[model samples]
Target: MSDLVSVAAIKDLLTECPICIEHFDDATRIPRRMPCCVQSICQPCLESYSGGAATLSCPMCRRRHNLPGGVKSLPKETVILKTLDYLKIQKGLHLPCTDCPDKEIAVAQCDNCGTFLCSICLSAHKRNTVSKTHTINTFDEMKGRPLQSFRRLHQCSQHQQPVQFYCYTCDKVVCVSCTVVDHKEGKGHNVVSVNEAHQGKAKSINDVLGKIEEKTKRLSETESALQKKIENIKLSMKVARDDINKIFDNLKDRLNQRRTILLSDVEGKSAENLKVTEEALDSTRLLLTKVKSSSEYMRQMRNKADKVEDLQVMGSSKASLNSMLKESPQEIPFDRTGVSFVQANVQHLQNTINVAGMVRSVTFSPTERPNGIPDTAVHNVITLEPAEFPTD
Candidate 1:
């Protein structure tokens, strides 16, 4: 579970655009590298921020960049895109076909229609007369193909025709008929063929790609370091758990030993006390028997005596009985046992138990730690907060 979460955290850090902070996708949110800072920004964010300007400032470093053609000219961050693709494949993910009602996996994409298709949908699409001439590429053939090489046509709203031209003055893509009727050059509109504008932006795009290549190399190194950090965290957790178990196991042994000593002490003293009391009880029973026997003899002699001898025997018996009765039963020695348990300092033991183990976390300096993680302190305790990644 820990490993899964850590890997997800690393992916979240690597796949997000620095500008919009959204995960990069193959469609509108595709990552594009800026020449100024060599930072990856999503395509939609660039389009919105550029706002048809001739130059755009880098969101990270604030360095101005010339948009010779438009945001479309900026090269895609191919490294990040490839990483995302590889991860998706590893996870067994499949993008759904655009034409499938039941969400079938896409096997091919139509360049002309700009829609993905499953095998069944592709067969139907090829059979349709309207789309029979459209250019389609299977997933295998599309591998490593540059995104800019694919041509997607959009229909002009006014003319309902394929847009083939760009009107710089109106800042819109227009069809040939629209250019003639509504966006003519004579009407102060600067219009140019899409090919011509693309050619003009080729040099700038190449320059950005070169910078992005270097940036991606650094990103790769950072990713490797992050992977190492995750492994380290897992190892640390395992070690801590083992330590906790060992300490508690030793404590249990000591407690059991103490308990056995206390029980033995009580049992031994109780046995000794029982022997002493039994001896005193035996002596008491013998003394009680003698007194009762003498009293009965005196009573018989007085009732049946008829001569001087009987009288003499009665007097002697009475004297002896009185002397025995005068002796106090309380004076007989019988020692009582005080064998019991006395509780130790409960609060002290409670305090010791509470502090017996601790989970500690430490923050390392920038030079000592991997990328993505910042040097943030959480004292000397474990915390459950999410890891923060640097945006710039």
Candidate 2:
């Protein structure tokens, strides 16, 4: 009896449904136990949460429970209802008599008949010859006492006698006569008192609860660590991307500068070569003019002038020819010049460009790593150098 009263105190500690945060009762707010996860939820809350689905998942544990017959198929938490009844009785709330059509408040309960009684019924029961021997206990006596002190034993379905023992093989409660006939000691059935079975199951439940708590804690920590690793991976990618951009940008700037310099050199060389060619052409043309005029004068003097005078003119023309000849047009002041582009180490430079920057992995031993470095941490390196181009 004291044990039942102590167990009833659990209602004050945890009476609310986890989903709706409402207290449970035997009526509309009845508690229903989930077979999958063994969590108790109120009937209305469970129904609404199911949302007409054939499978219902427990709100607390997320374990699925099949609803072949809907929410009604889930077992009711009778122990919780019993505790609620005890609380109501302690508070002096009215409970209806089982036999009263008007629903009169029960003043007492019959232990033998398992019926709540009004004042009038209690007197009539004592006067009845057949039921006068029935054990009767008043509710007033149960105000501060345990409800179990006046509770009736459960009747067996087949024998109609009070069940006294539990059959481990059948997982059922049976009366003494049924235990001897059906759940015998020499048979495969393991029989024990109701109290022993209760203690064993209670211990098993506590052990499982402790393990579940530890597993949940570990999983939460692992999830947080995984999230951090994902963030780190994104950060690493960004850093590598920036490095690649920087390297290519530097290479591009250097290439552009080289192009500009090469173009300028080509232009300057072309201008110098053109000036040399133009001077050579001017010198050769002047020499040609002198030679032509000197030759023509010599020919006219020889053909038309009188003997001695023509001979004198011939000497002067000869002198002019000698002077032109000394100018040597064959040896004109011209230098051979041209512009062309030649690429050096074409294959080698192409190969270098192909592998200029690469993504590489580097590992470090525990001792080689700096302090505070994670074991799973990865590093990235981007390397590039200016190519050495040959001068043209």
Candidate 3:
């Protein structure tokens, strides 16, 4: 039973607090006991430690516990017994400093004094007036030697302090000190958490990039369609031009043939009229010559008096010559029955030909009556709102 008690006492002494890396001595010193009872720490260390309430765990036993409120009473005898048991167990244990040449050093830290010292240093440290009230213990008395305490490390580039927040606009991590001094006063920058800023910007960029890609695709398709339409129009225009030129050439040839025939007919009629006038003038000259020759023959036969009948014949011939000289030339009328050189329908044909190259309107007949209404009953009236149809 004594051996078992000793072993139990030795195991209890091995437990230590995870926070300050120190053994629990007096109950007054360690106000908080972990749920496992293996780990305990002084009230001052528990209060000043930054590990909030969530992560209150023992380093040695890896057990979690809650802290006691206010001051509590503890048995003085129990405290003394636990301390004596711890001292005895520590006698066999040895700790060494990593930087020492002898490879043998005491692993004791003073809680009040905030100094790490060996047994010899502890004795001398106790003698000092400033460190006399400090609690001392070996490194092995502590639960975990190397405690991992996370601290804010990155400093704001502007303020030179640990960064705690993020600036979305500038895309940088900033500190609280920076927010007040540099950001608030200097640039009035907006700040947020680093993680939030990154996520928001990623979403925004993705949305915009998606729209850009869609627009680019639509533009490419539109360009291709427009190019095809332009080529079709060009081809259509060329065909229309060829058709118009062919129609004009045929009309021009017909017009020229008609003009030539009309001119030839006019020339022939004029020449015939001139020939008739010349023949009428020649007959009048012949009658006058006959009358003059008869008069001359009557004068020569003056000795044969009382030739009245012969003289009367010469006078009648003279009268005939004078009447023929006074008569006008006969006007001949040319036959113009089949001489329509300018067709009456030519103007209408030319107007139709001129419309060949134009953009003609196409009308579509409805296959079914709109809304199943008869065309005669349906009125094509449109109503518009005041805003939509503005008055001039």
Candidate 4:
């Protein structure tokens, strides 16, 4: 119940060290505010500022101030530190005991020393005469509330003194002792408070972040459009392939119908010719039989009866033959109706597709198109090439 941060409190959290643009860590991020400009700077920058000087200068305002007691004299910003505490609570962090070897969780935080303590360590700390008067709070009280900003005693690289001031010209954080003993206050060096610097930089970063968000949104839309285009292309190709197959199927049906018709024609014409030839053969056989009968009758008449009987049979046969001859030709003529298929050049038909591929009727127009069509979208000849069928 005590581990929660309010929405209004969340807005007040310090997410990063303004000087380094890095996220604030409890162990490293020590928040310090200068007196002249009331600006907050990280502990590292402060330690670097008070290099060898008894006096410190505000980076933004270039205002100089005396630092009698050094970096420890810098004021603590309570609001900023409270923001850090909220962040720790957000991460569900349990304060670790400083003296514990395994980094055991601590139950209380020392206000004077800024160190967390377990029950054993807390009792020991309380019993000690030095820490007996120090203020201590349970972990529950420490969470969900703003705490005072604390600065570590970081020794300067140059004079081993705590850094107190920031140099504007050099963009370096130095100690107040360095200003007097080492770096004398020089002209053309402008300095101001960390708050003013942090505010200016935060504004600039926000502008960039806004632009990045807009670009990200636009890119997302573009990606969606591209995906739709790809799907559309796939659909069109599938439809085209289906249409091509249907066209070939129709061609095969037509060819099969043509074959059936040709076969029917051949059968009808051959049947008619066979019928005529059969009739002619029957008539000829009848005539031959009659002639043979007549000759046999004549031989019989000559041997037995007389010339009268023979003349009667021969006269009947001659009359019948004359009638048959008068009706049609002596020999039956063969009448033939030829059937053939005119097949196309198979190679030429195959090459026709290649010809279609190379052929293009393009048009260049500067005038506006009629209706709602754009001139840029217009083309004279359009050819569709379908994708290859996937094997696997």
Best by lDDT: 2
Q: Which candidate is the best by TM-score?
A: 2
Q: Which stretches of candidate 1 lie over 4 Å from their true place?
A: 1-16, 19-23, 26-59, 62-93, 100-103, 144-161, 180-182, 201-392
lDDT of 1 by residue, 272-328 (tens): 544444444433433333333233323332333222222223222333444454433
Q: Give one digit per residue, the lDDT tens place, for model 3 in 235-295.
A: 4344434543444456654445433433454345334433543444343333333223222
Model 2 segments beyond 4 Å from truth? 1-14, 49-54, 99-103, 110-115, 125-137, 144-153, 157-160, 177-187, 213-392
Instruction: Provide the overall lDDT of each model, using Cα atoms, as 2-decimal numbers.
Output: 0.52, 0.54, 0.39, 0.45
Model 2 C-alpha lDDT per residue in residues 193-271, reported as the tens digit of each score: 7667655644543344344444444434444443443344345444544555454555544344544454454456445
Q: How does model 1 fare in lDDT?
A: 0.52
TM-score of every prediction relative to native: 0.33, 0.48, 0.25, 0.36
Worst window of 10 by summed lDDT in candidate 4: 354-363
Error of 4 at 175 (Å): 6.5
Tens-place lDDT digits, model 4, residues 1-392: 12211122212244544445455554565655554322345666666666757777644233576888766576444445545554564456766687567667778777667576788899989999999998887767655553333222333578866555545455555566766654556655554433444344335433433443444344344444434433443343344345334333444443444334434443454355445545554444333333333233223222331122222223223333333223321233322211222222223534332221111111122343568776667433332222222121
Off by over 4 Å in 3: 1-165, 169-177, 184-190, 253-392
> Candidate 4 at 345: error in angstroms?
14
For all candidates, what are the clash counts? 0, 0, 1, 33
Q: Which is the winner by TM-score between candidate 1 and candidate 3?
A: 1
